[model samples]
Target: MLRYIAFTVFLLVTGAAGADRLETSAGSVAVTQVVGGLDTPWAIGLLPGGAFLVSERDGNLLYVADGTVNRVKGAPKVSAAGQGGLLDVTVARDFTRSREIFLTFSKKQKGGAGTAVAVVRLSENGKRLTNLRVIFEVTPGGSGGRHFGSRVVEALDGTLFVTIGDRGDRPAAQDLQNHMGTVIRINRDGTIPGDNPFVRDQAARPEIWSYGHRNPQGAGLDSQGRLWVSEHGARGGDEVNLVHAGANYGWPVISYGTHYSGQKIGEGTSKPGMEQPEHYWDPSIAPSGLLVYSGKLWPQWKGDLFVGSLKFNYIARLAGTPLREVEQIKGPETERVRDIVEAADGSIWFISVGQGAVYRMTPDT
Candidate 1:
């Protein structure tokens, strides 16, 4: 049976609660609210000089600083329909010097059929995207508007890790050659990484890094240099994965969730060669954006993994252990969380996917 999720209203209306100690297998500490009241904010990017950039799914880019916000100019026009819009925005790794930004979005294509992923550079002056480009794109064959799983991350090696959705095609998830249902790795200049798994394969897109994902909306790097991804399963199998080169995640083939009619998904939960998730949620937390926090403000949370939820509307603090829940934080907008990032001052910032709100969580002053 299909489940229904309710969205919380604008986040600015909420008040901060006193800090409380957290308990986790990895470790935990106090959590305090810093600021709130954002409008369907979808993603956050921390600038070098203690400034912040926030994206609203409805196509507005916001600049938040000191205790206020200002709208940026020239946001790309987007579809903003069912699960589509000005999606993700991120600061370039060299932002301290270059003052450039990169992001992904689902914009309307020529036909009413598909959506394309655009990666544009945000000017430092917050005026317009100077060097706009569609670095990599997916097949725009949307049937009923679901699953673009588009999240962008700059790898330590200067490669871009991009997550693509299964495009509402179940069986295609197992197809080795398609761009859908795969994590793609590309150079910052939009070229396929030479060392990618499919780079030399004539049958596969050279950019394909890993395969068999439903919609991995969240990705981040931990202290150990491991790349972690959070994804939504068919109905119940929300997963957290440690990404490995050339691994297949086994989406439609095996899942913690059953079919719409309560039938089996595929062969089974475990199969040969397919890499299983490091952790998964059976009841479906609808995990969205992910961040491995390293800020000093929350020294207790330094090196811990923080994930946002769409259905649960909480920022879940998970233990580094294989598969177990550690802490669930419900203070943000209580809406579908779209992205989370560490601020310049070591604070944690996040955005709401529907209400277009941005929030900050910091240690007790």
Candidate 2:
């Protein structure tokens, strides 16, 4: 069964009687509400013609267009337990011709639940989804619900990268036989990419591209087509990593943060084979959605990275050679930012779980 809601869209204006303005390092930005009355919205996909899609954590896909919000039918059945549920959504690169979209969610498997991906064609009317297909499913499902890590990114080579977490089983991150705590690459049709890191490794899963990740909730492609992810660490070690093929991110074995109980985790921070994060946050901000800005609208922010802070209620802007957080874009509207992205017109769009609304930010004129 699908649920419907009345959505309100505020007028886009700068300094227009009661407009929300956020001051930034570059300049002030006008924040306009795109839509409101959402429940735990997880991700947003901006389609052509100014319409957009929003996926709610409780298994509802919403299509907002022509000043109306309608429920998108045919979403896959989700576990919707603990930290797992319908998570990320990405529009197909050739969406105009294909009308296809991809989704990541926690699938209800035999033992418990695990992350999975599906591809479906949106109907021309945009009211329902058709041709639904389950493209990928994590093997060896876990018993608990924590750490689904369900972020999906489409690479420059027309392949897909799906991030998985340890499922609260820390040691499984080091094991290569299972899909837990790993990023897997696949073709749009769900076939394993031949160039994958472990394609020929008899003992490793053929779909594995990288391993040893804890709970990577956010993934994005930079301007240069490089992949990056925002990961959650226990206690204080939230990390932004430049993802590379076949590399180990050192989750349980090496972490800058300690256990939640205040005990030291792993053998210190640095290990020979493990890769260090490009940036990390102590006292954990609980990072989620990540975006590599194109600098189309804001030239000064070219090549900068934007990540939403789930715990701190802000958008982190990171730049420079070593990649450090340069600014925190925060206001009352940014509370519990779940996902952030660049719109077609170069405007910045983000979802705020705290506000239960979608907002667009533009340079205040």
Candidate 3:
């Protein structure tokens, strides 16, 4: 069932005016609702003319403009079961001319359900979608409902990166023969990129870019165009990794965290060939969304990373040479932050699943 909280009570908890002014490490900022009355909003995308697209976990797409929210048609059918549904939406780089957008969802397949990516043209009026086409779908769809790591990101090089979880099949993460627990790199048309790390490996899936992830729900590109992912750990080892081509991120093998039952995880925390996380959380915050700030509005935040915590009801700000959590941005408005993105004007936008709303954060004068 979807979690619901009284918005009025939330506002009262913060302050008057339905906006919260919170002091952060950088400075005081105002958190205001952009839109509300949503149902389990999973991801958000910025559209031209200042409109927005918000995807709900139950297969509803919302178009919010001028304070009015409308349902958008033409989203693909989703499984909507156990952490699965319409997940992420991304606007095309040339959206002004292309009117195109990309979406990632848990598709119902022959075996059960798996993550899939589809592209569609938003109608000029923004009331519906057009020319919808499935670009890619996970092969060997699994039966379970948990751990569909389905965050889609457009790389600086124009290729697409889709994050997939272990699908609750731990051992599958270490096998390159399947798509589980891996990052996939593909062209816009859903074709495998020739330069993908495993494209030439006969025993590996050509689309595999990196492997051994747990449940990477958050992905973003930093200023230098490098991909970074924030993933859930078994019990307490949530991690933020600087993803590299063909790198093995020790999942069921090594971890700073152990099983929920306090049992030791595989072979300790370091293995010979497995990569270490840039940062990790021992107590586990259940991280969901990621953003690498450009600092257009706050210069001090440039090169810093922002992550949403589903379990903690806060946004984590991390920085420094070795990388660490420098601050926590939290309030009643930050409940279950599912996705975080930077607006074109450099303001921050995020989804609050607990409150069922979209919020924007801007520096206070």
lDDT of 2 at 333: 91
| Every model: Cα RMSD to truth | 5.5, 2.2, 3.3
* Tens-digit lDDT track of model 3 for 1-365: 12223433443443335667989987899888887767889999998789999999999887877655667888899999999999999998888999999999999999889999998999887889999999888888989789999999999888999999999998889999999999999999989999999999999999999999999999999988899999999889999999999999998899999988999988999999999999999899999999999999999999999999999999999999799999999999899999999999999999999988889999987
Q: Best-fitting candidate, measured by TM-score?
A: 2
Compared with the true structure, all predictions reach lDDT values of 0.72, 0.91, 0.91
Question: Per-residue lDDT for 1-365 in model 1, tens only?
Answer: 01001112212234335454544333443544333555466778787766677776677777655544556776667777777666777788887676667777776665532334455555655546655677767653555467778788888887888888887888877887677788888888788777888778898778888989998989998877778899998667889988999999999888878776778888889899888888888778888899998847756667777888888887888765565567877643546777888776776777766545565655443
For model 2, the superposed segments whose C-alpha errors exceed 4 Å read 1-5, 8-18
Error of 2 at 272 (Å): 0.8
Model 1 regions more than 4 Å off: 1-38, 66-68, 110-119, 332-335, 353-356
For model 3, the local distance difference test gives 0.91
Off by over 4 Å in 3: 1-18
Summarize candidate 2's per-residue lDDT along 205-241 as a digit string, tens digits: 9989888899999899997888999999999999999
Candidate 1: residue 85 Cα off by (Å): 0.6
